[model samples]
Target: MSEPRPAYYAAHEGLVAEARPKPELWRLLVGLGLVAVVVTVLNLVLFSVVVGFGSNAVAEGFLTGSTPLAMIILLSSFGFVTLGVRMAVRRLQNRSMGSVLGSFRRSARQFWVVFRALLILGLVIAVLPPYDMGAPLTPNLGLSTWLMLLPLSLLAVLIQTSAEEVLFRGYIQQSLAARFQSPIIWMGLPSLLFALGHYAPAAAGDNAGLIALWSCMFGLLAADLTARSGTLGPAIALHFFNNLIALLLISLPDNLSGLALFILPYDMSDTDMVRGWLYVDFAVMIVGWLTARLALRR
Candidate 1:
């Protein structure tokens, strides 16, 4: 007999049936478009709200600095993505939006469980041979600032990264998996889309291709973890902690560097530097997936 399907597979049967009852392809496309519009409108509203608060530094602070207000505004747009997905799911599936999270309590439990494991994993990575974290970005923001931003930043990054998971892993992956019996269609298609979206030809230059490859590999790992654990929690845990280290702990000093704790030494637009970083990123992605597997093992 074939192996049993995961619980999420059974739960989402309505969405993936041949009848396409929960969300047909046309509906999916429309939902995404609707999300795009909502995100834009919400961001504009947030920008207005921020500027009206008697602080007129949206341009400089939001684009490049350590302004706490900018940090919140810049990264909070992902909340809208979460909202958009919820709207789409509720309208199309007529199911409680919680289904996307798989098992809520279980997923939340798994998230912290995996997060602890990954933090130790991060330390292991940092201490590994031949990997230099390079210099910290200039002008440390002090203890109080970091303490203040810690909770807020976690909230921001969680919203940002979780929104992505909801879209790619929860919405897109589940939808396809519901429609197809094969893992290739359900898994690979979403990974391909995720990888393509990560490509920034202008910033990545020649390494954009490699970056896409790494992202695709990451998506594969995340998708696998989601299936393995029977919930989006492990995947979200893996993604959130990974990003917590990257975006908050260390980051490229570019337009998006406002909230980063450490700025990388190398320039993001440099082809050679980015290419070298890609190698390390690929290694990390593979290692991360393997680590998640270890954490989920019975």
Candidate 2:
């Protein structure tokens, strides 16, 4: 006798079926290696081109610094990861690009549905009391400049978040679930990898472990939404909106604050303050996940 499939995973069979043909762990590992190589080579090429053509200051800041142009370039480069995923799926898995994405129409529709729910939640949170952060937020971008850059900034964030969802939820989760019956193996593994990617000790410093733990829980929640919805839409929407708030709206002054409208007085290394904020973020994330689930139920 087999274990019964949970109701939340009702739509996951379609994704698993798509992965059935090339479900080998070796294939997944090799595919990831290929993606890394592709990303490296492309970034190197881009770097060389920028350095050869641009000024020394711009060249130096392009990858390491957080100017608006630098941030846009950095975020948009994640498209290479999406391209690499496509290539790997085509070559190694012998599958179409659509194979990893479940259903295009369903994904698109769900993206809007979840995005709308989150947008409302965001507005409600914004209007609630005690909005101040114990200090006034420093203005980062001029209103006119930010407005001018909004379209491109949004596109960059969409690319970054969607690329991540395509790789983690669409490719890794689907492939793992196909090979393993247990959600612990399939969901937990990809979520762990996703968490590892966010473990930034150099930046987060003393708070790095907690930040990574937060990322792991976030990944688990995202993985859950993907499994339940059977599309990358909800996860992508969640990630996109979260990042939109962090990167485009208000941000930490020390990092990635270029395109933001306002900047926090404290940095990520301000562990005590940031840790408390992280708890708030955790609560918001949970509510957002539940909201997404409820939206799907409608």
Candidate 3:
């Protein structure tokens, strides 16, 4: 006798049968636009009220308004909203959220390996000639202040990174994968969106074009890793290490003892750093993709 179909599969089938047709892309886009507007307004109001008492209204307001703390709050709020919506939708279909999330969780060991890989790669870049350190390496905090804020900074990074991963690699990628069988749509769409999200930061000040190109390349690599791994582990690890390097270790000129950190032998004044870093980024992407494939092979 044939084995019985899994209850989860049966439930999925039943839901598909009764499920309403997918909404138009325009509708989805409008809903997301509204959510963005609401979040922006809420964030501004909170920041204005909270920091309004400070001496420098503009500086304090902006620091409070756009800092990682604000990002964490906004992202966590959205994460919870997404989680609730998914849970409700699953319940309506008699499905378990745990099962759904479980399907995407990766091995802890693999995750750690990816993190170590990124950390080492970043360190290597720091030590190599023509490093340029990319940006100014100035620590805003004194030793005492750093001690007090390090934990908070780390917590903020974790929250911010987790929020992005959940939104892009988890929710958006999975939804796209389910809706469209094409890997290009599942991976490319999120990658493009992620890149566009960095446009403002990347386009600000000097070397804007180079920064934007690198930012988009990073997004593409992260998206490819997510797609290949079928998990957010690699991308999260890479992003965490990327932020840590850019924020802490390499962010101090004095910290560059063993290697020259801020002076590049070759000029980086090129409009786009794409040609220079493209191969390197592509190599890292391949490593990430291959490592993920190898881990999943077992």
Candidate 4:
């Protein structure tokens, strides 16, 4: 007799059940191609319009600058990815976007639960001693100004994080799981692609590989959460808080520092210090994952 499927997969089955009937490799490839075409064309049109109205330098700022408006624009563009995924899933798989998420009500409830748990954990971490870097953080936005922009900034981050979860954990993972029995195939493949997306040699220099590895680990944990919960909620909540801290709270001095209240003193190329911090972040990530898992029990 064949070994039994894992308990977590019980919930995941619902997420992937619709995909199984149409789990053709050609369909998956075509869906990916459609996503690529959609995002590329949309971005091109969006940026072209920006350049037409604004100077080239101004348009570039939306991509690379550290200002709040720039950050918002950059983060919000991920919405196009979500749109692409929805189109691909609906047209290719003959499934509603809601089906990709397993259950809408469960997802919404789980998201808030995990988010609240993480928020409390974040507050606790903030108070911990010996956790801070020695150098003072550079303030990017004034307190009053940051507070004023908080609502919109939060929305932008939710858009970016949820879009990613929808693509990786929602579309890709579900599609793969539908076609394969092994978690290694479904979970590992999406995590690999997600990691590759985070690879940035130009920005991180020597730390690029390490950063990519961290991203891979993050992807796996997020995938596990998605599988266990049978919804993108837990994964999205995990990603949301992580990005909220990184993008809106404190970020690296260079790259994606826009919308942050404070920027780190050291750049990504500061190998020794950055690597040390990455280790701490890795620990924190595991803890966050465990916390989310526990939260789901309640």
- Overall local distance difference test of candidate 3: 0.49
Residue-level lDDT of model 4, residues 1-298, one tens digit each, is 4245588668888899999999987888899999999999999998888788888777878778567777888888999999999999999999999998768899999999999999999999899987667688889889899999999999999999999999999899989888778888888999999999999889888888998999999999999999899899999999999999998888887778878899999988788889999999999999999999999999
Candidate 2: how many backbone clashes? 0
Better of 1 and 4 by lDDT: 4
Q: Rate the local accuracy (lDDT) of all candidates.
A: 0.75, 0.88, 0.49, 0.90
85-152 in candidate 1: lDDT tens per residue?
88877776554557777768878887877878888988987787765644445543565677778888
Per-model TM values vs. the true structure: 0.87, 0.96, 0.62, 0.97
> Can you write out model 2's per-residue Cα lDDT over 42-94, one digit (the tens) per residue?
99998898788888887867765468998898889999999999998888888
lDDT accuracy of residue 190 in candidate 1: 90
Q: Candidate 4 — which residues are off by over 4 angstroms? A: 1-4
> Tell me, what's the RMSD of every candidate?
3.4, 1.4, 7.9, 1.4
Better of 1 and 4 by TM-score: 4
Where is model 1 more than 4 Å wrong at Cα? 1-23, 51-57, 63-66, 134-140
Model 3 agreement with the true structure over 165-214: per-residue lDDT tens digits: 65565545555554554556655677677776765533243554445566
The TM-score of candidate 3 is 0.62
Q: Candidate 4 local accuracy as lDDT? A: 0.90
Off by over 4 Å in 3: 1-31, 53-109, 130-139, 201-206, 250-298
Provide backbone clash counts, one per model. Answer: 1, 0, 0, 0
